[model samples]
Target: MIETKQTMMNLPGPKAKAIVERDQRVLAPCAGRVYPLVIDHAQGCEVWDVDGNRFLDLAAGIAVLAAGHSHPRLVAAMQAQVTRFTHFAGTDFYSESMVQVAEALVASMPATHEWQIFLTNSGTEAVELCLKLARHATGRQNIIGFFGAFHGRSYGSLSVTASKPLQREGYFPLLPGTTHSFYPTCHRCPINLSYPDCQIACIDLIERVLFQTTTPARDVAAIIVEPIQGEGGYIVPPPGAMQRLRDICDRHGILLILDEVQSGIGRTGKMWAFEHEQIVPDIVASAKGLGGGMPIGAVLARAELTRPWRPGAHGSTYSGNGMACAAALATLDLVQESLMANAAQMGPRLMDGLHALQHRYPQIGFVRGRGLMIGVELIEPETGAPARALANAVMQAAFQRGLLILTCGVSSIRFCPPLIITAAEIDEALHLFEQSLQACL
Candidate 1:
């Protein structure tokens, strides 16, 4: 049985309030705070604020802690590595940990092709690496991205990110030779087309329209896409959409880059979300859960694709820190052994409960996801328009009820708990979320 704790006192109790007050003065205003609660410590699937209020963590540090906070195995590995040596700058120096991690990551790839790995310090950097390799390998300039995607905040990745206009506000001129197309969606079709009948007109638009008009296919280096739209609501593409994209890329001789930064690493009950489609990408960017909370990212590509870039082409001072690699190795071991299976088993249970909630409350217009990466879209019901304000209210209410959830897309709440979460914990979280929804309604 799982023990659950819901805060009884007013939130931000003294100590948390003081810290938030200090933070407001010191931190950048751009750093958005979902709630006023200040984290004191976290373990497994629960976190406690400075005021000793315990809350169930459904966000998992924005889907980073796949092994859960401070797992004994991960802590031991990181501790052991730290004692031996902390930093040796794998860019110039030799480190066994880096090689081991690279091997482990490559082993997780689909068995269809021979692959290699380049490690980075964050998801954004991994994306930047993919952008550089794609452009270099093809010697082409133009790259295509979907309408609703969040690659990263870096200049190169930002060019492909179109999740929200706020992220791009005043940030131009973005990288040249970048264009956008609508991602295939069944829930909210961008082009007002239905599935099967529409026959993924979005993909056809890429070839027939985008290629013919603004950007020529000959100059296109790659098409960067997220297997499942992350920040643009957890929108999953219709069946065969990926395979169709692969065929188009093949025909055009354009590289396909899968940015699995948020949807990868067992979050979707698979090592990589792209496995669901059984398609092989020319380059893949991964981060969020790769290091199990430690800062690490990686770009995996075929040997021929990356071979063109010689040494000293791109390197970071903290590309492959010894401790981060140790953490990553431990994370991979746990994911392969049990966490991925756990996600597969618990995902259906969580979704069923959410679906039930949808029946009870029509405000939950839609619920869709794979594994722990679920999204519940809120709508006004009468007009069938996005209830963005209501979504924010529900998220805040959930926090007040000792449940930590985040909002995404236009008016959707994302439930991305750690993969280690059990059935009992899922039930508890569902109960709390239901209560919060009721209160907000």
Candidate 2:
């Protein structure tokens, strides 16, 4: 495994503690601070805390660093672009980098049909734009989202998000005409039904119950979903689930929107998680790893659907900022070159190790994911209930052991290390994780 100082230092060292003290005074309360990890710098999958403590970053800034931290290519591209010019009002004016970024995004999409892109500053913006476009194109008012799905935090995107009650608490009366349906989670089925044998009834209910009783299919503009639910837990829907959704959308003329914010950019082996189902989405929302840590989001939609919008219909000042575009181009190049394939190759290695750990640790109720975007759900051994506190404790314990991990859903530990992570690093992470588990126990 990767070598490191064998002894673990006292966490939140003097320097980190001081920074935390200052941050607590100035930073907003909403800024969720999980562990006291004051980062000084990072390279690849390794991070150095402010007090010189080292850490293996399995979270990757919530899976935004597809090319790892401070990748030379990304740094070079950003430096070169900033020196040339950073922002030129991309929506009002033209920039070659902006055009090239859009071109690259279109080319990366499925070749079955022509595609177009609308660049934004984050995945939330992309989702907001996608929702707007869906309504505009279909002349419909209603949208369908899955339960336990997170689209974004913006007013429009947040309307469809239901990952946590806390996220939507106090901010009520989200965008009108938005309804939530049950996501096909086989591990703990919402309807208490088995998979395959259940015939994917969760999706069918949208038509049989939802459309007929509440939001009519004729008025529903779109059905937005995450191929692999991220915050709701790294829950991967069973096979044929996506195809069933696609078929429903086709029959009802509802647009299919895939929120690839976390699962896109080769995190799930494929360039986009929806590809795993061999189905195409009308619009795809991407961000997170797209810019290799730089802030950039995009809405890739069928060309014909976006034609209704006039010149000044929808736009953003930083829609295609030169620096962001350059970073995106460089990041996409790295992902396409080998990182994508590397994720596909290394994913099995990591998952196999996790499975072995599950066999030994009964608390690991379920392990599911694709590529490097994996999650291990912790449950009580006797009751089989979600061990939410145990997951949090394990995450904190891992941090103390020089490993950075995060919890998602109710009791799942998400592992989304940078795509550039090596086999040795995975082993090291697993070892640290098991140690943390034992300590927590």
- Over 4 Å off, model 2: 1-8
**Candidate 2 lDDT:** 0.94
Residues 376-440, candidate 1: write the lDDT tens digits. Answer: 99999998899999999989988998999999999999999999998888999998898888888
lDDT of 2 by residue, 265-301 (tens): 9998889999899899999999999999999999999
Per-residue error (Å), model 1, residue 289: 0.4
- Candidate 1 has its poorest 10 consecutive residues by lDDT at 1-10
Worst 10 residues of 2 by lDDT: 1-10
TM-score of each: 0.98, 0.99
lDDT of each: 0.92, 0.94
Clashing residue pairs, backbone N/CA/C < 3 A, model 2:
none
- Give the clashing pairs for model 1: none
User: In terms of TM-score, how similar is model 2 to the real structure?
Assistant: 0.99
Estimate candidate 2's RMSD in Å.
1.0
